[model samples]
Target chain A: TQLLEQSPQFLSIQEGENLTVYCNSSSVFSSLQWYRQEPGEGPVLLVTVVTGGEVKKLKRLTFQFGDARKDSSLHITAAQPGDTGLYLCAGVKNSGGSNYKLTFGKGTLLTVNP
Target chain B: DAGITQSPRHKVTETGTPVTLRCHQTENHRYMYWYRQDPGHGLRLIHYSYGVKDTDKGEVSDGYSVSRSKTEDFLLTLESATSSQTSVYFCAIGNTGSPDTQYFGPGTRLTVL
Candidate 1:
């Protein structure tokens, strides 16, 4: 089974601070996706990176896929209280016959205080 | 947002009792998935359905069963509840063309005491 390891399980910062969360794995992935979930709600997809060294930006959030496709990262610029939530990284293994199944990381819980 | 709804948004049951959670979707997606979220464990897939009357077990299928009788409805059942099974359950719908992106329902919080 493939595993994605996320770093800094818990993070707390004042509003306007910049933060980056990393997800690493030994196995290469065909695709990687980022999701943010608020309390009492299911996860919502933030972005998806399919190519190595790919980067995508959504408003104040930026996501990058590693050159080796074995890791990914999410960077938040000027974090706000509204951005506080659980961030999750999920990946589809390169060798998996099916693309529907995904391996997920534990997640990073971010709290931005105003 | 996806047109997905889960019934019994919250449920509390005793050990050995049976419990069932219903998922309804209006998107008419071809794929539906069931997942359980636990602290520090992330989200684990319990089961999924490819089409009506067609389902498959996921990584954590033990003690859980799923049935899909219609395109818009999927059901998950627990034969005998256990404290270990207590967790937040989420239902997701996926399009046949784009399986990677799935839309999730609000979720159901189940507590087995």
Candidate 2:
């Protein structure tokens, strides 16, 4: 089984503080995705990185894929209270014959205090 | 938001009872997946369907079963509910062209006591 290890299971910081979350795995993945889930709701996709050493930015969030495709990072700049939620990283492996499955990390819960 | 909906957004039942969760989608996507989220376990896939009447087990499919009789509807059944099965269930639809990107439903919260 492929497992994703996420660092800093819990984080709490002031509104203007910047933070970063990391996800690492020993197995290589075809693609990696990041999601943010709020209380009482399903997770929403934040970004998908498919290439090695790739970086994508979404407003205040920046996502990067490792050079080996086995790790990813999410960095938030000047976070706000609205950015508080659970962040999840998912890795997809090609199962061949139109079958691809995703393995998710335990997730990092962030609390941005006002 | 995606055109996905889940019935019985919240449910409470006792152990040894049978429970079924429904997922309906209007996107007409070819792939659908069922996952359960628990504390410290993240979201684990229970089952997935590739097409009508075609389904496959996922990593945590031991105590769960799924049926996809039609393209728009997928059902997950717990033959005998247990306390361990109490978790938030999420249904997701995958794009045909991009299998990695999935749009999830609102989710169903099931509690078994």
Candidate 3:
């Protein structure tokens, strides 16, 4: 089973619409990160949240971390076509022995029509 | 980015063949990782390195091995490739600051027939 779960698996909306992507987990994590990936490129870090109940904003996108550090959400305001990509959320968890591993969600594939 | 590069972005091999993929980073980050991305599975880590000659297995390490002979290069090898081993491979480097952020190289697509 995946440590992180994201929904909905696929979303398509028109430009100027608003949407939210969620990542939930039963296990608590040290940090949560959001990444966006285009068709032919690797995923790029969009934002990282550490503190519980922390919130971050990058332009039209807003990211919120749950108070328990077990969940996170990404909200896009007035989504654009350029935002069409795969949105992934990962949680950082200690694997013991001075090592940390990232557990990633399956990702939400979003498409915005212009 | 972060000066990370993967060689032979695409490869096709037959079952039972041995294959090696290379990842080189110019940023001199202390940690390097290898992950395989597949549909519905997201990215599953195969192996990682903490420093020169210091490597460890990750969640899905079967049929795979890694070597870090130097600070700049980390290599992932398939001892005997199988059809199930075909997937997109990504290399990442990080752990530079608080919370540990990673930067990935363009992925390599591998196909085993």
Candidate 4:
């Protein structure tokens, strides 16, 4: 089974609409990260939340780590076509000294119509 | 971008052939990783290197092997290419203090026909 589960596998919305994508897990993580990927490119890190119940904002995007560190949510306000891409969430677990294992969710493919 | 590049951005090979992909970084980061991205499977780690000559397997380590002889380069090899191995591969470098924060290379698209 996938360790991390992401909701809304696919999404399509008009410009200016708001949307939220979720990443959930039954196990706790040392940190959670959000990434955005475009065609022909690798995923790019958007933000990282290290503490439980932590919230971080980047421009039009808001990211929150669950209080129990088992989940995270990414909310986009007034989304634009630029926001159209595959959003992925990964849970970070430090296996040992400085070696981290990242478990990625399937991801949410988003489309924003202009 | 982070000064990372994957050689032969795109390659097509036949099944049963051996193929090797290269990841080179100028950031001098101590940690390097290899991951595969396929439809329905966002990205899964294949292997990672903590330092030169040190490497470990990841979630999807089967059918794949890695070698890190230098701090700036990491190599992923497919002993025998299979149609199932056709996918985009990514290389990443991470900071020691914040391993979760990583920078990725453009990607290498490998088509095993």
Off by over 4 Å in 4: none
True contacts kept of 1: 0.58
Q: Which stretches of candidate 2 lie over 4 Å from their true place?
A: none
Angstrom error at residue B20, model 3 = 0.1
In model 2 chain A, which range of ten residues has the least summed lDDT?
A92-101
lDDT of 3 by residue, A1-114 (tens): 448999998999999999999999998999999999887678999998999999999999999999999999999999999999999999997666556688899999999999
lDDT of 2 at B4: 96
- DockQ scores of all models, one per candidate: 0.64, 0.77, 0.59, 0.85
For candidate 2, what is the DockQ-based docking class? Answer: medium
Top TM-score: which candidate number? 2
Task: Report the C-alpha lDDT of model 4 over A1-114, residue by residue, as the tens digit.
Answer: 339999999999999999999999999999999999998888899999989999999999999999999999999999999999999999998889978888899999999999
Ordered by lDDT, highest first, the candidates read 2, 4, 1, 3
lDDT of 1 by residue, B6-70 (tens): 99999999999999999999999988999999998999899988889989988899999999999
- Model 2 chain B is weakest, by summed lDDT over 10 consecutive residues, at B94-103
**Clashing residue pairs for model 1:** none
Off by more than 4 A, model 3: A96-98
Two-chain complex of model 3, DockQ on C-alpha atoms against the true structure? 0.59
lDDT of residue B109 for candidate 1: 99
lDDT of each: 0.93, 0.95, 0.92, 0.94
Model 3 chain B — which ten-residue stretch has the worst lDDT?
Answer: B94-103
The most accurate candidate by lDDT is 2
